[model samples]
Target: MTEQRPTLADVARVAGVSRAAASRAINGTYGASEAVRRRVREVAAELGFEPHAVARALATGRGSAGRRERIEILIVDPDPEAMSAKPFYGRVLNGAMRALGDQDIALEVRRVSALPVDDTDPPFGRVLINVPGAAGAAYARRGRTVALGRSAPGVAFVAPDNDDGGRQAAVHLVATGRRRVGAVFGPATPCANERKAGFLRVMSGAGRAVASADGDFTRARAYMATRELLEREPDLDAVFASCDVTAMGVLRALRETGRRVADDVAVVGFDGSALAEAADLSSVYMPVEDEAESAIRCLLDPARPAPARLPTRLAVRGSS
Candidate 1:
């Protein structure tokens, strides 16, 4: 007698979950928590349940004859030229590529000036970079979108502990005996705001006041902002740059102004990019590649909730 092939129902029965939940878990979609997904997969493996490819394709709205499954990475950057100058995005792409190893999925990269309003042909999933938290919610109506940083409620995202990173920067500067501190703040994005807030909170707690200037997350802007900050607070003993690129600008500004780094004014930057290591600048290191990998995994197996915040630490260098 031919042995009947194990079914999803059998797996669900063993896992003690509803048929719908079992299907969701197996298909790696939302509505199934990590625990549920794990149990379902384990049961499926024990029961030797194999999902029919055609049925899966149909369920996911990708028919066998349909276009290949693809994940689109939408970069919301106004200045296209900035893409080449930024190392952070390169790291993100590298991590995404790593996470996609041997997966039957294609990746598409696109730079957009603004979020699209049209509900055009959406890809299988989307990875949003440098987008504001408010604008992220709109993508929920489009398709499965996983943002790289903090996003509005109900939007799936993966991000580092920017606030904690900022706090670490403040603590380091203070412990290093820097009294008068200045900050080059990034653009008014959710992640940037969080970083700034955390820094400010620590400084305030220590009874220290920080003078700040706005930078557009660019070297040029940060250079100008740092110069302006110096003009406002000539006795600035330490500066916190929002990112490594911005830190480069701050360093350049300090050098051009006859201010010696680590001796005259200690500097600490965020992002912990290669730029920081090359310059030997003290920085708060955030695992950007790991965050990117988590984001990719979330898009692939959306059944599990993404991690709210990844760990961050301070990498002390000569700059501080």
Candidate 2:
């Protein structure tokens, strides 16, 4: 069994000091003197009392510091701010917004398409990024972090288990007796890599080696990427794209490759976006709304054990 975490009261009791003195010493604010701060620090270190904003707020009235947007979700990406045009982002933003509403923490969504953010702009406590980019993260102040593709220690993320998805997809294809399997993936998103890895595992499990090449999550490149993958592995019977956007592209390649859908090539996709229903693409429908919800929850409960991977389901269709 795990031991209970220590609180400030525990630290004060051990330090032989009052909780008010401990608060001032811990926060380094208003009333504590140098000797008291030193004593408190020593005792806190001994008791393992990590200062918590929620706890500190209750003691110091910090949480009520007026919700002038204390929590900000800063997007660090080279891509244009076309969030309104992208279905994937819209759903994610919706979930995040709803979660924020429940928490009552002010939230700001900003994109860094332009360089050298104005210093006059409010500093965010946390930063979010789509693809890996150290430049954006390097800008945040010390109290915050630069969130990358998915979750990492001390940072929050909202991404699928791409590698597991890949493995699952591969296993599915192989179980179906597909002798040759290929994959097309999204840009360098963490979800892309995990799903790709999962697909590779499935193919390998089914005794098929994957021919790897990737496409940006778009219909055109996905189509072209699929064509090339199929050309390299002519006997390929199944294709997996990292997302539905790419699946659309794969559809074109499959139709043109002279291979009968499912008979010769069964295509599967991830991110089961609107295209899955609109175009009848075979895919694993990720609980994007849930993904958003979890991202918010993780951000809120930075203290909790990393939440379990969110759920997803396979949506079989004409393509598969």
Model 1 regions lying over 4 Å from their true place: 1-66
> Which lDDT tens digits does candidate 1 get at residues 1-320?
99999988898899999987788789885446789989999999988899999767765545757756788888988876766888888898889989888666778888888877775788878888887767777876677899998778989989999999999999988888889999999998878898999999999999899999998888999999999999999999999999999999999999999999989999999999899999999999999899988888888766667986999999999998
- Which lDDT values do the candidates have, in the order given? 0.88, 0.67
Candidate 2 achieves a global lDDT of 0.67
Worst 10 residues of 2 by lDDT: 139-148
lDDT of 2 at 67: 35
TM-score of model number 1: 0.83
- Model 2 agreement with the true structure over 1-320: per-residue lDDT tens digits: 99878888898898888897788689764335567789999999987889887866655434665433345566644556346435677677777777666443556677765545355655424546562444434543343443534644435455555566666666667767777667887777667767776676656655677776777776767878887887777887778888877777787888786878777788888877887788777788877766665565555444334455665677777777
Clashes of 2: 12
Error of 2 at 243 (Å): 0.8
